[model samples]
Target: MARAKTTYVCQACGAVTPRWQGRCESCGEWNTIVEEIVDSGVGAGPKSAVAGGRPVALVPLAGETETAARVTSGIKELDRVTGGGFVMGSALLVGGDPGIGKSTLLLQAAAALAEGGRRVVYVSGEEAVAQVRLRAQRLGLGDRDVLLASETNVEIILATLQNGPAPDLVIIDSIQTLWTDRVDSAPGTVTQVRTSAQALTRFAKKSGAAVVLVGHVTKDGQIAGPRVVEHMVDAVLYFEGDASHTFRILRGVKNRYGATDEIGVFEMSTLGLREVDNPSALFLDQRDRDAAGSAVFAGMEGTRPVLCEIQALVAPSPLGTPRRAVVGWETSRLSMVLAVLETRCGVRIGANDIYLNVAGGLKINEPAADLAVAAALISSLTGSPLPADAVYFGEISLAGGVRPVVHAPLRLREAGKLGFKSAVTGRLASSDQGGDLAITEYSELAALIGQIAAGGKKQAAE
Candidate 1:
């Protein structure tokens, strides 16, 4: 008999190496390479797959199909993030940092689903049943009847799940602890995670039960397992928040059944995670409109219109390289905006030590926020407060032009609903309808800069 082969895989990037190395060449992550046997599991050759499985008949694309059934969790935010409700027989992977309320949010959702007459099973591999019970009791969910188990073996879990009728929803707390007898690799390894995820996902598809898999995030805030695990699932939702803040965001990065880039807002409280009906209002809480360098960004998350505060502070830097700090927004985007202001608009904003923040800890990804960030920076540099009742949304080009963004009418409607009086944005497209709010349209970044500086001077004169 031929001996099995072994290979080293980088836990960070899932790159296979011939031998052990101190640093991963693919990802540059140090000490992440681990040895694993490749005789079976996902790393096995094509013969392993074709040797045992029988060929099935291929079906045509034209066929009768039933609409997907949804089970609502009774949590507005959770449902919104899941595109109305959880689709039956779907598999979802939720990833977040430790102590970032991933477990808490799932516990709450399970309880809510149970209350709504859905058979929900919560299998925890990271904590005991008693620990889960304590959290449930604290969240006032002790009265609800939720099936709970503490197990890590994938075979055992699948067996237990099969014994009873297929459940409506099954949640596995932390997929890293799951191990399979088929894989020689230890738990939390790349092969084990991938194999276990494949097993659970296969069960979900065959059993007509929705499965929620919780994943652990690495130091870089990415899910620790192989990227294939994310691809296998039907949806991937990320729970993001700061420990210092009460607000947590559930953003959908990949959804086969729903829209991508959708976000649901939640607030942590003594009882449990409370759904925020009006996220814009909660995000804009305690508005200090009189302060300089504060701008309200009219943004869109999927189809939902959102408004958030963008703040910037510019100060003299003694170091030759001015320090640039950014939070809740991309650092590269900030650098681009700064360069545009300097090279194109002639704003000369590169010499100061700049700090930018998107209040409420909600990260902005769209380029529409560029104009708002620029407004905040210019306002801070000139010590001028923008209009308190105004919201801004536009994309700034490298050639100093302010480009119009999609959903302009939606952004304005949301801002007006929140009592905003005006909006400063790019020229509205013919298809983009206008709202009742006053619109301040701009064509160029330099034109906007001149207006803001002139506004500061006029305010000073008054």
Candidate 2:
């Protein structure tokens, strides 16, 4: 028997140190270092020569003879986000906050595939088979002949998939909860999470099974456990939404099969998770009629055109610091917009507590929302709101000039579909041909503010 050496690893950055430290020097996070034993007794020989496993050299996939076929994951919204569907033998990691529907989404997808006449197996590490059955019944999935198992051991999972009947799709309730006997650490630790993920990645490739791994997120929103877990997977999808809100978004952070920026929206209901086809309409629901401090923004998330509301409130701050708060939009980004208003537009809101929010619990990070933010601030400051059926999409510079945004035509077309009367954008001449909707363009923020204060009133009357 040989003794194993131990090394202290930073849980935050995965930097290994000889000894424990109070803080991780690489990531600057405090008290995140943990000691792990490095076992050196195992032989560094190829196990691929064994009867069960075979190895192949890596080569360019373009040289391979594999034909690209679109395999639906069974969830329509998820398929849209993933660029039609999951590729054959592709592995996906779905991560989200607790109670954010990560498990439910994958389970629903598995049921859908089973119903589509494809064999699907769901291995639950956290819940029992009965619990999974109960949830499946609620989702109206009884007609499908899906296999379910409640186990966390990686060997059992692999053996079941290998020797038993072939399944088209395989789903693990969570990757963090699964553990391998080879690793001496507990489940969800760096060693256990990384090792099991690597094994599953290999299994998915060899068995030609589309694997979906449910992942847990840390407090700061990164996938929990080892960083290597994300690297090992093929695609990383993040399920993001406020638990208080019914709408949840499945965004592809990384995708080997398709575009990474796609997003799928869903609404949680009593029957399970239901996909929202017309997300723009759902986002604009219950919008106030010609209300102050409100403006619509035509923003593009990935290739999808979304009409989101930008709500701003400019009120006197009771606090001495004049607080600045924003929901669904970055606070730092909002601060820059406020400074642009003060310097370029000459609409000072320094003493007032400015607050901005994106309606329908959807967060907007695109620069196209800049014009809408500016217009909302001005509408609140001057007490002259834009028309209820108006929307803005353009980026504002520090010097108050309007910058052109990407996909202006798509934004305008979607706005037209939503019955927006006006499309305020940087490309004024280009939008003149758009029938039925007024195209207003302003080079300077001050001029735009002036137009929005007066012209908005006229548009409302029309």
Candidate 3:
């Protein structure tokens, strides 16, 4: 009898090593290395079981292709995040933190699809069938005709799917709890996750049924599995929201059939997730127009324009190192903005404890928010309240120059729709300045800083 070979694998990045180590050389994560048996016989070619396989036909690139069919769930927000609807024969991986409403959202989608007269199967590996029913009843979806099952064995699940009439959509509650008999490792191990995902992906492709796999996320907000699983799926959607907030954002990080970086906003309520048709209004509902250190930012997410508030506080620091606390925005980007203000604009912000936050728990990633953040920071430093009806957006370069960004018209239109009268932004082309709002163009950051400081002094004298 031959002995089985073993190798150490990093659970974070799937880097395999021959010997055990304290930290992973690939991802620099500590204590993520685990020993697993290596199956040498896996993927080996069959010797005499059958004759040689036939060759596959190849087609030209210019051939006519039909549009992929999609199944529309009645939930418009869910369908929007899924590129209008769930594509047939596609595998989507939805990941989020625990209790972040991954299961709830999927259940709602499944119920909607079933109500539309489509066959839907929801197999749960993490919870019992009774628990799922209880949740459905709580959400008022108990009357839906969605089929439910509770099992984690991959082989049995595949067999059950094969033995019944082909369903239009299949949902796996979670991939971590699933285990395959072929792999000797535990359920959540890297090998098992990869193998199970591959099997489900193959099944979806062959049966022409859309499959959704729920994945658990790590403490750092990444999906808890091998990175290969993400690559194997046709789409990847992340459910994001702060626990303290009622708003939730479903963002598509990767999509083959739709636009990437697209988001669908939902408001969590006692009934279920309610789609927010106008997320801008929801984000700006509690704005304090009279407060200093607060600026409304007109930004773009995918093709949609959004307006949100940026709040900044510049207080005298009591410690040797001033604290820089930020939420819902990148910390390094904040540092870069501060550096530009200090170096080029001659702002003495280093002595203050700077705290920045994006109201409504929405994360803003566009560089266009640079001008808004800078405006808020300067307003806090000078105790000057920005114009109550003005919005801010523009990218600030390292040289303290305000650069123009894309979709200026869209941003201005959204601001104007929200009753904002004026916008402070980079110099715009004549064609992009046809909006109803007043535009104040600045080529450099120093000019805006000077204007705000002068306004503050004038207000104090009065």
Candidate 4:
């Protein structure tokens, strides 16, 4: 018998090296290189053997194709993030921090789908059948028709799945625990993960079933395993929430069939994950109109419009270097906003320690939040409260100009629906400014700063 070829693979990046090294040259990660037997099927083979394969029929790109059918989980929030529903023969990878309701959410979704008369199979590699049953009972899903299994061997799981009628949906509690006999590496290793994922993906495509694979996240919040696993999947969803908060966000970072930046909101409770139909109202549940540093921001998430509060605190610094603390927003973006305020608006806030936060643990990534954040910082520094019924949304350029953002009509419509009577935004086109809410357009950031400072002076005199 021929000796198996051994190679060193970097667990961080899946880069293979002939010899072992302390540090991975590809990803600069240390101690992540592990020795593994390279399967001949995975790597290059002999040229003589490859040349004997049958040729595949190639189709033109203009050929007609049918839209993939969708299997709705019956959870509105879950379905929304997945672009209406899970597509047939698609593989979705969901990742989250430990105990962040990943399993709970999937269980609830599985139960809902099962109750709707769809065949659903949940295979848990991390928990036993009894433990899963207990969880189902706790979540009030013990009576559902969802099939449960506790297995980790990829071959056995595939065989069992093939034995029954092809399930409408199959959920693996986590992909990390799955191992295959075809690979000579331990479970969760780079090689095993890649091999197992490829097998499951192939099964999904060939069997016409939606496969949902749970993934573990690294300490830095990235999906644990080789990045190639993410590439192999059809869609990637992230379940994010702070342990201290009950709200969980299901964000779609990649989707081949739908929008990539869509988000679905859920509130965790004793009953399981409850979908929030109006996420804007849930996010701004604890609004304090009298707070000086608080400003309401009308933002867009994918095609949906959301209103959130941006809070800022500016205080005298005791240290030579003032502190800058930010939560739910980027720190570097805050620095750029501060620089624009000082250089163009003459807001002497550099001497003060600044802290900014997006309420309800919701992270804002759009530049349209610039105007709201700037408004909050100025309000806090000048000790003035902004208009309670007004919403802010506009991007601030380095040259101190407030730029118009897309979805202006949607943002204003959502704000108006939530009882906001006025909005402060960039100059809007004539066609986009016909809403019931009074709109104030500002072209320069300095003008808005001057108005806020004047409000502060007026309040001080009173």
Ten consecutive residues with minimal summed lDDT in candidate 3? 39-48
Candidate 4 lDDT by residue in tens digits, 331-413: 99999999999999888999999999999999889999999999999999999999999999999999999999999999999
The CA lDDT at 354 in model 1 is 99
Model 3 stretches astray by more than 4 angstroms:
40-54
Better of 1 and 3 by lDDT: 1
- Where is model 4 more than 4 Å wrong at Cα? 41-48
Overall lDDT per candidate, in order of appearance? 0.93, 0.82, 0.92, 0.93
Task: In angstroms, give how far residue 268 of model 3 lies from its true place.
Answer: 1.2
Q: Which pairs clash in the backbone of model 4?
A: none
Top-down lDDT ranking: 4, 1, 3, 2
- How well does model 2 score by local distance difference test? 0.82
* lDDT per residue (tens digit) for residues 248-292 in model 1: 999999998889999999888998888899999988999779999
Candidate 1 least-lDDT 10 residues = 44-53
Q: Candidate 3 on 203-255: residue-level lDDT in tens?
A: 99999999999999998999997899999999999999999998899989999
TM-score of each: 0.97, 0.91, 0.97, 0.97
